[model samples]
Target: MPERTHVPVAIIGAGQAGLSVSWYLGRHGIEHLVIEAETPVHAWTDTRWDNFTLVTPNWHCRLPGYSYAGDDPDGFMKRDEVVEWLNGWLDTFNPPLRTHTRVTRLRQGADGGFELTLVSADAEQLLTADDVVIATGGYPLPVIPTFARTLDPAVRQLHSEEYKNADQLPDGAVMVVGTGQSGAQIAEDLHLAGRTVHLAMGKAPRVARFYRGRDCMTWLADMGVYDVGVQEYPGGQAAREKTNHYVTGRDGGRDIDLREFAAQGMHLYGLLEDGRDSRLQFAPTLRESLDSADATYNSICADIDRHIEREGIEAPPATRYEPVWEPDDEPTALDLAAAGVTSIVWAIGYRPDYRWIEASVFDGGGRPMQTRGVTALPGLAFIGLPWMYTWGSGRFHGIDRDAAHIAASIIDRVARGSAGSVVTDGATLATTP
Candidate 1:
């Protein structure tokens, strides 16, 4: 038997998504408790590398009750600055938060409420709540391919989440797989640190940091790209699978083109196909991959240019990005021992984890089957999932909207007695009027 506590609402996670919803719940005078496994914003403070900075500009960081008021609105915030900002925001709101408490399990209680099993260093406790908001974030685990196990055990391997700085890795050439934002940035970091970096390219798009004197994010926001909903956008399903464009917050802000990396003497390869012992095989689509990335980047820039002209927006003079097709004559296959590659970093994005959730709220693919944060189950909701509602739903700029929507649903369920099945419109999970 464990200690039992009852609350009207239970919100899991204390990141931006959790805090944003907490702010709204507090404003509504709703009784809720936020449970966090570690300090608030643990992703920024603990998981991120020391040199990590936000991919989006500072002005894009908009929470429910707080907004960035710093001088450099157009600049990107580093890991520490982001942590400090989250801490300040948490302190200002002072929501009911239980730190160091991890929710190990969540199931339906005997009384039709949610029963959460919370574990801490001191003791385990059971909590019952009328409503539960799962804001535990979208990226819970790093995705590594099965072929990684085939690599030589002598070579040190680390996921992007585990990597901190170049000092932590062994002395030798490094091969970084996956050309998403993390892969691109980490390769650049290693290259600048005097390490021979070999980057495996993927299908991630590329975008210039600043275009037409405005940050790329600013232009996207102005063009309502962020507001595009999942169902509303064409090929939304495929779009959701695509990784964010390759850009860096480092060195002020600039485009991190793969061609530029090639120019910087970094070895570029197509996707890692198979690995056995010290030998590795790569796809022979290096040229095709580079061309595809450049085309995607140029298309976005062209859209921005057309938008500026159509709206008669007074922006700085723009320059078109010309692709520099420089094909390296390196072999598609490489022996790690011969190349002196001592370490490998897999910056291949993340996947959602729902093992602790005992309820049947997830689809077959382990993704929560919620419509815009509202689920078919009454008193149950979700926030901070990618493409939850809009293109930016998972980002700081978009979390507030999803949070507010979920908060409203939770409030309505609580007010309606928190019982019976929820009526959803199939596409939009809004309560019947």
Candidate 2:
């Protein structure tokens, strides 16, 4: 065994989440190490598409003591611009970051802390820390269905993260699975590029980009939708399971209308059910999914309408969205060769992977069972989970707040010499003053 290094705290990611935690801990003069398998902002730099942009405006890109300083606060930052913006934080505090380091195993230390087995550059190293913060974002592994292996080798397949542009695919129609943000956007990208597109739509909701003379998100922000707590949501935990509304920040911003895409010669299908070679089966859900998305869109419009009237804000006149296109036939099956779909993009989203974390703190779904980032176990916590506390918990808009609370909790534990007041269920962690 390599010599075990000891530290007061170890943050297991270097993304915005871990860096935000480091900023807060540094403020309190706490010593910690931030370890990353890649450089800081690895996901931003590596995973996203070339044209990828923040769905939220630049203003929402908030870290500790860092907010968008660019002139275009209302504009969305493109992929490279986002990378540059996030890299600015590395300069702001110059955190203690260890790149090219991967924690292969994390287990409870024999004596009152945590032990991490690391493999980096073909060398093994061991680390022990009194406290550990798992700040990796909720999505860890891109999930492609097992049936994907049954696809004919002639048909190229790529996950949404792997898709760069239409030119990267075979010179034929493209099929994009799932109607989550990525799927919708990628389908649109291919369609705009004049490539034939077959989109498998899901039940993901849609929101208008602009409403009543302002960005819908701006109104929602003012109405405190983003600040609504997990417990406060009417759907409760189910709200966290819902896919995010499909919209886009590409070329300024716009609402993704799958109906319009269908009108423009793009073949839209329902939820994919199974596959046999180049032939795939789909559920007869095209109309239902489209209606459901529009219902959610108009619902948000109605909520915003009421807010505008209640607050007497002089906003533009509002009207409900009527469906621009309707599906007359339910497309339940697709023959890839016949449809000329030479490529398929699996935009089915990702699953969380915490196998390296050897602890009892995770739920059945592998999510850390933490309340506002504090676990029931002493000296262990999680940050950057979707809806961990608020809608902004995993995004830049709220990482600072969550990190501050967790940092305060760590500080309290350090002072008291034991973890204090963390509970397994429905307990709120104290906010730092």
Task: Give all TM-scores, in the order shown.
Answer: 0.93, 0.95
Worst 10 residues of 2 by lDDT: 422-431
How many times do residue backbones clash in model 1?
0
Highest lDDT, which number?
2
Q: In candidate 1, what residue range of length 10 has the lowest lDDT sum?
A: 421-430
Residue 327 of model 2 has an lDDT of 88
lDDT for model 2, please. 0.87
| CA lDDT of each prediction against the hidden true structure | 0.85, 0.87
Please list the residue runs of candidate 2 whose C-alpha ends up more than 4 Å from where it truly belongs after superposition: 417-433
Tens digits of per-residue lDDT, candidate 1, 1-433, equal: 9999999999999888988888888876789999999977888867788788898999988887678999999899998999888787877777899999999999988879899999999999999999999989886989988988988999999999998999989999999999888899999889888999988888888888888888888899999999888988888665667788889988678888778778878888987888989988988878888888888888888999999999999988767788765785545898999999999999989998999988888877898888888888888888888888888888888887788778777767666765543342321233443
Return model 2's CA RMSD, one decimal: 3.2
The TM-score between candidate 2 and the true structure equals 0.95
Report backbone clashes per prediction. Answer: 0, 0
